[model samples]
Target: MTTQEFWNKVKSPEYKVTQPRLAFADVLVQNQDVMLSAESLYEKTKTIFPKTNLSTIYRNLESLERLNMIYKVTTDDGLNLYKLKCASNEHHHHIICTKCGKVLDIHFCPFDTFSELAGKAGFTITEHRLELYGLCEDCRK
Candidate 1:
């Protein structure tokens, strides 16, 4: 979404839209398709707001995640990366590049047919998350 579009949503009563939060959102919106670690985000945010703190960045990220404005993906190497949620509200998973930390969204859900199996096992499945990992094209070269 454009910065204006993002601000329009942020203006809702559900979000506070503080300066730090707005700066964080700007960075994410600018790099919408890229998955960034907290440190990476903090570094970029500092460029936008020189006084920004690492803890504040983390707090903003957590708040955005809680608000469903962003999602986190843990890489195979155990690094937590985050990106803006898809503009569409569809359910999807991500395929991450372990070598370069790139992310690609996959629109299909693996559990589409598992409900019957879950019922047979006397278990009810509520939600699930799947992250596929491998080298991206550039990383493979």
Candidate 2:
């Protein structure tokens, strides 16, 4: 999405969309497919807004996550990584490259069969999260 488009969405009643939040969103937009940690994002945002602090970065990130503008992925090492959420309206999952931290969205959802399985087991599903991790094509080489 363009910067203007992002800012328009940020105007929602759910968020205030301050300057620091815009800077944070810009960084994520520029690095769309790469997952970044809070520290890493702070470093990047510092280049744009030198006055911004780590706490501000964390706060903006939390707000963006709450707004569904970004998503979090925990690495195998237990570190949290984040990336811009895809703008599609469809339900999907993601595959992350363990080596390079590159992310690719998988449009097909396995839970499409949830209703069938749930019927057999007589269980009610509330919500779910599914993420796949492996080496990407470039990382495999």
Candidate 3:
């Protein structure tokens, strides 16, 4: 999402747009293709606004996540990464590059196949997440 669009979603009665929050959002908007750990995000945001703290960054990240303006995924090593939600309004999943942390949107969903299997087994699927991890072309080289 663009910086303006990010701000538009953040402009609500519940959330106040402070400088630190704006800086955090800007960093995410500028790095849409990257998935960053909270620590890495805090460092980048600090570069833009020196007064920001890690706690503030965490709060903003959690709040934005609840607002559906950001996406979060945990790495195999248990590191939580965050990325700005893509501009597409359609339901989608993500494929991440393990070597470079590049995130690509996957428009194709395997939910229907899974759902059919669940129905046969007398089960219902409530929620699901599909994440694929591998090296991107540049990272593979």
Candidate 4:
């Protein structure tokens, strides 16, 4: 979506558009492959908007989340991370590292096969989140 369109979505739900919010969205929209924790995003956005604070980042994240423009991801470490939800993409899962908190994306929903198995077993599955925790290669080294 164009920046204008994205901001329009943000505006639709009584959300205020500000430089900090715009910058925060830009980071997620641009570096989409990397799911970032609040602290990581705040640290990077600060270079462009030096006055940006952690509180502001958190607020902007909440606003985006309210609009469903982004999704909240909780790492095993109990840290909250955010990823942009693009309408063009389908549902997916994430693979995150235990040692370094790195996140990797799985483009398709990982539960379809499990759904089949559960059906065979006469078990109904409504929702699920599969988080595999382990050391990433770099961390393992």
Candidate closest to the true structure, highest TM-score: 3
Flag regions of model 2 displaced more than 4 Å.
Answer: none
Report per-prediction Cα RMSD to one decimal. 2.1, 2.0, 1.3, 3.2
User: Which order, best to worst by lDDT?
Assistant: 3, 2, 1, 4
Query: For model 2, which pairs clash?
Result: none
Cα error, candidate 4, residue 123 (Å)? 4.3
Q: Which stretches of candidate 3 lie over 4 Å from their true place?
A: none
Sort the predicted structures by TM-score, highest score first.
3, 2, 1, 4
Candidate 1 C-alpha RMSD relative to the actual structure: 2.1
Give the alpha carbon lDDT tens digit for every residue of 1-141 in model 1: 987877776565656767877788889998887788999999999999888999998888877777777878876679888888778789888887776667788989888679879989998999888888788899999
lDDT per model, in order? 0.82, 0.83, 0.88, 0.74
Q: Which candidate is the best by lDDT?
A: 3
**What's the lDDT of the predicted structure labeled candidate 4?**
0.74
User: RMSD (Cα, Å) of candidate 2?
Assistant: 2.0
Candidate 1 lowest-lDDT run of ten: 8-17
Off by over 4 Å in 4: 1-5, 8-13, 97-104, 108-110, 120-123, 131-141
**Against the hidden reference, what TM-scores do the models get?**
0.84, 0.85, 0.92, 0.72
Instruction: Return the clash pairs for model 4, or none.
Output: none
